[model samples]
Target chain A: MADLLQTPLYDFHVEKGAKLVPFAGYEMPVQYPLGVMNEHKHCRAKAGLFDVSHMGQVLLTPKSGNIEDACLALETLVPMDICALKPGRQRYAFFTNDNGGILDDLMVANRGDHLFLVVNAACKDADIAHMKNKISDTCEITVVDDRALVALQGPDAETVLSALIPAVADYKFMDVAIVDYDGMELWISRSGYTGEDGYEISVPADNASVFVSKLSENELVEPIGLGARDSLRLEGGLCLYGNDIDETTTPVEAALTWAIQKARRTGGDREGGFPGAEEVLAQFENGAPRKRAGLLPEGRAPMRAGTKLFSSENSSDEIGEITSGGFGPSVNGPVSMGYLSTEYSAEGTKVFAELRGKRLPAIVTKMPFVAANFKR
Target chain B: MKYTEEHEWLKPEGDVVIVGITQHAADALGELVFVELPEVGTEVEKGEEIVVIESVKAASDITAPLDGEITEVNQDIVDTPTLVNEDPTAAAWFFKMKLKDASEMDGLMDEDAYKALID
Candidate 1:
């Protein structure tokens, strides 16, 4: 705890009565005075501000000064169609290992001249090193340390953001732009993990507090913390890197194949080039043995992570294990996601989770327990 | 009324005592989502886990404060768990038990001692 780092908005979070907890070597707010339940609901209805500065932000500049060179260089590492990514858009991607297991899930944005990436906090250092060791010859990797990233998410996010920066009104989901605000360049991305219409803004570290303060002033915006952030993403059916998907889990098994564009698939222009391309492409052609599925417990009791799932109430054979589970405030019940045997992965299938020595009944349901509201 | 270091409160009514958590414990646990109480006829020893509580953040257990036989259980809190957060000491009373030894209450903390412990 003594060596834990603080983000740019540390003092601001303290001022707002945040319950700070250690996360990925950083002292982050687990929840504010609003608590996790209400904070989660607020993010779905109105707007909630989140401090995401703990995540890693890196820029990739091409050595040949051609953005296509950097994109082609990145293709050697990830399986995404980075070369076809437009200038003002971001795509979800992951760094796959030689075994097809995901190193970390990340966002890759083509910022015109350079590629901007945001990786998970715990894997930031390793992700940067992996890129440098692999693609440094073709592209110069620069870690952006002097910026603070924050997410403003929910139904009212557009109304709240457009008021501050009028140009944001023209942007839709996954759109990225560098806009001027009070002579400062703010990198804004119309994307978030909450399955809501929102924006992830990167402000200079020195002005981070001021920008957050301005957002907090809005009647619709309340400062949210990590607790609510986790619940919101859980309800949105989004994966938490270390929880749902990890070094041992591949994108196909995690049910994230939708993020892999057609150009990177089998028989496409850039097929079988990235790490683990053999296994990943094979899984695409023939389904993976195990697949991630959503779980809706019949009772109010949450069947949390590490809970073993059986095919039936009295069965000793384990079929799966819960990866993420908790009370979903919006759904008013326990919602969860986990890897299940391909046989039990279909929606509406009945499964049993062992909790406290009792086997609880649950149904395999479609995810996004709460429907997404992104402005497409 | 007596309190335990585990944040439970006991109000003696004749040979039976009503059990529930304190407001401080409720606040610390945040919003409650589920409660699992013991069977009414079950006999529980002191320090034995008897009840399970789940909040949005995580799940926790409530142990038997003293050796006793559960005489009754609160089904309301089991249905609507948020009652524990709204009125932990009153309406959210988890159960009532007949003590195996009434003298066990003598060693518990008083209101002031419990306040000092929480503070």
Candidate 2:
């Protein structure tokens, strides 16, 4: 346990009655004294602050005036359209290995001056090394390890933030801005993991604690932990890095094709350049062998990752595996998401999930298993 | 006749020894979101795990109160987890078993003794 890292707010969380547990090699709060269901529902209804300081933040700039050339160089690595990203907007991207498996998924925000990236905590070190090797002297990549990240998420996030930092409300969804709240400056992004209107603020490590404490001053804001974050993201049909996605699952198979730009799908202009481009392109044209599907479980028996998925029509022959699942507090029932064969991937299609020794009835459904209320 | 350090409580009735988690154990677990029950007729040793209880954060195993063969198991506790948080000493019994370790029961703690053990 000594090997696991702690965030800047680690001690603060312990003081606030947070039950810290190990996750992704970090000692994070699984829930507070209030509990998981309450924390989850609170974020959907009001505002909740999450200490995401464990995520990696990096800064990158073009070698010359050739930012597009630099973006293309990186675009050769991920399938996302880096060249098409507008200033102040962020896009999702995935890293693929040689066999079309996903390495990790992250958000790359065009923070006007350069680019601000938020990658998974578990993969950050390796991801940084990979970026350093692929990117040359033509581009500069710097790890902003000195910064601490906090997310204020929910429907009233903007209202609460605008009261403290007036200019924050001006940005639209997926847009980012750098602003001054009181005397300290923050790089604020109108984005978050919970399917609600929210803001992710990046502040200097020294000020993160005080700044987060200041936000918690509001009666509406509570400090949320990783447990609620996991269930909340899962209820929103979002994937966990090691569970839902890994070095063995491809972006196309995971139903993340929406992240890939249309032009990039055909490998237009610059072709066959990225890792697994050949295999990824073929799956893009021919359709993938398996696809991610949301499961609405028949009863309250919560299915978890690695549980076998089957179809009763075929005598319970295994068809897939549940990658992430739990009782969705807002939905007031059990929900799950995982990959399934193409023959059983259609939304509304009937399937069965093996729970304990019995086969529980399940049906394919559209994602965000919980409806999203993000501010457009 | 007794309990384990894990706070599983047992009371023998003829051949069957009724089992449930202790109030001390339930208080620490908090909110009792999920409970995993053992099947009927399963033989359990004196120190073996027989049932599982999960709060939101972690999972804990309830060891066999005494070596026994499960005769009856509770389905109501599985349906309503909060019973463990509410009436842990009564309606929250995990199962009823034929005590195979009746001679070993003297080693287990009583309610007052269990409370003192925590202190």
Candidate 3:
């Protein structure tokens, strides 16, 4: 624990009575006194401020002083069409290994002069190292370590943000803009992991605490913790990096084909030059053997991670295992995601999860269990 | 009243002893959404898992503190699991059991001893 790092808002979290736990090499707040359930509901109804500063932020600048060159270099690493990404727009993308396995999922924003990236906290070091080893000569990778990211999310997020910066109201989903907040420049993005209308603000570490305090001062805004953050994203059908999507999982198998733009796929100008393009494109044409699907347990009992899944007809035959599962506060029942054999991945397919030595009935349901309210 | 390291509490009320999780356990478990208690008349051994509690985050098992036959179970908690978080010590007792051997209570910690262990 001595090696655990502290975020800029560590003191504020402690003052608010957060239960700190070791996460991604940092002592992060898992939950507050309001409890996970209450905090989850509060976020859906109003707004919840989350300390996401643990996520990695990096800037990529081209050595040739051309943004297109930097975008093309990035295209070699991921399957997304980086050149198609317009300035002040963000897109969801992931790094792929040679075998087509997902290295990490991230957000890529084309910021006119340079590309801004936000990677998962746990995989930031590896992702940065991979990029540097692969493309450092063509594009300079600068890790932005002096910033703290906070997300204000919910149905009322726009209203609350408008009160602070009236210009934010003009921004739509996936929009990114640099705004001046009280003499400090903050990178504001209309994007978040939670499937709600929200904003992720990247602020200077020195100004993070004050900015968070000011945002939380609103009556509708409450400071959320990692516990609720996990449940919220789970209900929203978003994949957790290490759990749902990992080194062994590919973007196609994880049902994230939407993130891969048409320009990079087959029948396009740049048809499949990224890593694992051959395997990925083949999977696209022939289909994957297994697929990630949502699971809805029949009863209130939760089927957690590592729980083995069996065909409803036979208890002895194991077909898959739960990757991420918990009681979804919004769905009011146990929700889970796992890789099932392609035949069993269809919606409403009956399945069984082994829990406490008993085989409980479950159904393959469409995620998210709760509908996303993104301002698309 | 006595407590176990597993956080189950026992109160002697004549022939049958009442059982419930401690307040500390409830707080740590957070707001319980569901509870599955052992059926009445079921015999359970000490250290055997007899109750299952589910929160929004995860599910946990509550073990039996002593060898006993469950004489009664609180149906109120089965209907409203939040009672476990609201008043775990009193109204939300899980079950009442007829002890197979009352001497097992001696191995349990008293209130003050349990407080020290948790603190």
Highest-TM-score candidate: 1
Angstrom error of the Cα, residue A303, model 3: value is: 1.0
Ranking by DockQ: 1, 3, 2
- TM-scores of all models? 0.99, 0.90, 0.98
lDDT of each: 0.94, 0.83, 0.92
The sequence of per-residue lDDT tens digits that candidate 1 reaches over residues A208-261 is 999899999999999999998998999999999999999798888999999888
How does residue A258 of candidate 1 score in lDDT? 92
Q: Write the per-residue lDDT of candidate 3 for residues A130-196, one digit (tens) a residue.
A: 9999989889999999999999999999999889999998898999999998977899999887788
| Cα displacement (Å) at residue A127, model 3 | 0.4
In the predicted model 1, the residue pairs found to clash are none
DockQ of each: 0.90, 0.33, 0.77
lDDT of 1 at A15: 99
- Docking level for model 3: medium
Lowest summed lDDT over 10 consecutive residues: which window, candidate 2 chain A?
A: A265-274
lDDT of 2 by residue, B38-97 (tens): 788788886786676766544567777667788998888889887888899898888998
